[model samples]
Target: MQPHEKVKQYLDTICEQIRYKRIHNELREELENHITDQKQAYIAQGMDEETGTFKAVEQMGDPVMVGTQLDRTHKPKPEWSMIVLTLLLLLTGTFIRLYTAPRETNGLELFYRQLLFTVVGIGLMTLCYKVDFTILGEYSSILFFALAAIIVLLMLVINPVDGRFIYASYPLLLFPALFAGVVYSMSNRGYSGVILCGIYFTIPLILSLLIPNITITLFLTLSYLVILTIAIQKKRFKVNQHHALLLVYVPFIISFVVAMTNNNLIYRLKIVFTPSLAPMGVGYMGNITRGIMKGARLIGQGALPENLQGLTVEQVLPLINSDFLLTYITHRFGWIAFLIVVALLELFIIRAFVLCARQKSVLALLVSTAVTLTFAYQTLGFVVTNCGFYLFAPLSLPLISQSSHYLLVNMSLIGILLSVYRTGHMVHDKRFPEKPDRRPFLTIEDGRIIIDLHLD
Candidate 1:
């Protein structure tokens, strides 16, 4: 046998003992390099080629033992804590929904629906955990455009709840994650790439604008801002930091300004800050929510004011199962429920952020960070609205909101997050490799136009 065959056979035997195939290549490389180094060291001491190789393999303990040790070391591990937390949150949401809902046919119906979403959500989370998410980064552009196309298409269909096409903003919830992929794809493309990101952002921005859905508009705006900031801070772009930031925020700033001036959004903000100004108008829910909070006791069933016109407290603000679930729990049960819910949600987001930020792969880090921020913002929006700030019209707490549509969206986001944490160690990405000076799309030498057919 050739001298190198000994090393090859050693590695093969070692790999055979390791069951997790995902790290097989890395394990093989590590062992091969180590054996080669030992063989060369022996050769430097005047040993012949075959003797060096044989001696190296013999001195290294049994391949089975080595591989067994490594098999235990290198394996794909899921974040069971996050998984358990997710299931707990889902159960909390289901219980709260049934608790808030009337005890009748309608309540049982809601129970069944929540049960279905919960089961489906768990299944989706499991599937996402099993599948690798790195491939999403591979087809980043396709996913972005496909998402953009869906946003545009959804704009044409009217949302039944709000009677507005843009109000059907479910797709907008995922904009942040796919944008992470776009940001990764545009890596090393320079200022032009950064500008393309802004351009791509406009599709959803405009849809949100026409839909005039402030919640999603702000969701998209903040998501891109945070993500691009991360990219620029990391020097992922090939342009000046200041310049790339300018390119990124120009559209957001413009949208913010346009939204403030155009949509009576300014009036809405005014009422949210000072609910009494429109106590029976846009601020009705906020005003009632504050009333409920003021009357809430520390541990017992709090009383709703006698003046309010409602058969039950749910009739006062009407979103008992979703946007106002926290408020309902606080007022109806006690402050303890509120604290528990807040603690769980806060823990989930905080820990998720800590985990996501630790990702070694750039794409994984970016995507997971974006997902975390989306969760954070939506939670803030929902909590603030429940805590007597602007009702925000349609903000829903992640797992706490029991709506069918949002249940799916929230589950999908969790699934993606679980996917990231599950594969954080298993999947690696080359998102920022130095590119070869391959053929350019266009050349302008000698005032002549040369379109290069070779695309890298």
Candidate 2:
């Protein structure tokens, strides 16, 4: 081997054994530094430069062995627990749509359609798993603004099927995720970044209000607050933590209080907590849900409300297959089934929290936290509506929903969360720039080199 080519040759050989190509340059840089340091140490001890280089290379062990060990250590890990929980949740929802659904209803048709959504959801999740999640941080600016603009265009300009812009809610659910990236972009900018984020945060809330989507508004608010609180607690912001948090939360408190007092929001809350206030109309669903729940048994089935007067409990719920799934399950298979579904969802959420804490990068942690909390929001909403708090209403919870839009959006978010679990440790926002990766897949043909440029 040529004198200067030895180190290059050794590194290339070691790298060849590694499977994760995105990390190759970083690993090569670290290994090169170590080898260079060892070589200089030998030279300082009076060895010739050539001998020093050779000794350093020899000391590092066999290239293939070193590479194999590193590849094992650095390989992407699939969160099997997470994956299994997801599949179980999907199955649980499917079973409810198929088996627990009323015999008189189109249960088999609902099952078939759910099966299709589940299949598509899994595909989106898998595609996201293969993605580089950290890029969400790098392009936070354009994404946040552009998505905001798209919402306006769609809701105001496009004004699709309904004038109410109900379709905006699906895309609106994604705002918090993109806002996570926005927070990352501003982490180093102190209070100004917090202010900027607060400004951008209103876009979704406002758009949701335009759609008059209170559920989504609450969803966006809860998600924004969680993201903001976590960022402050982590000391991602350069400003004083106390002041930064105050700047972020005082407005939230004041706004919440004002909203409560300024309109019937407070009265509606009262009726939700005390359903008798509007038993005939506003609290209609709440009263029915309460009566049925009170009469539920541990197993078998629950008694229907006296006021059912001829219609099934499922007929009363706004969207039994999607929103009031747990309520329906309780009425069909009893509280045991309800408890089982609830426990499964709770476990999956707890596992996601553990995954979020395990992340080594800020972008991954923030985005993952956002996704996890969004899941929590939807779940809590469903539970509240099921428990007779009809003022807030229920939002869709992934595979458990009949709405195709909910299935796709929720699955896409899950995909991003799963992506964080998969390649999160492998990507750093700064290193993996927003620009397209030019790194080519290199292979040696017989006596020739072929470069396969993969467009991300």
Query: Using lDDT as the measure, which candidate wins?
Result: 2
Compose the digit string of candidate 2's lDDT tens values, residues 111-176.
677688778978887877777676678788898888888878777665656546867667888888
TM per candidate comes to 0.82, 0.85
Candidate 2 similarity to native, TM-score = 0.85
Counted clashes in each candidate structure: 0, 0
Off by over 4 Å in 1: 1-19, 25-64, 103-105, 149-162, 166-168, 210-212, 261-263, 309-311, 431-456
- lDDT tens readout by residue for model 1, 178-275: 88988888888766677678888887788777766878887888888988899888777655687667666776688667867855777877888888
Best by TM-score: 2
What is the C-alpha local distance difference test score of candidate 1?
Answer: 0.78
**How does candidate 2 score on lDDT?**
0.80
- Minimal lDDT window, size 10, model 1: 433-442
Which stretches in model 2 have alpha-carbon errors above 4 Å? 1-9, 46-55, 100-111, 149-163, 309-311, 425-456
| Residue 382 shift from truth in candidate 2, angstroms | 0.3
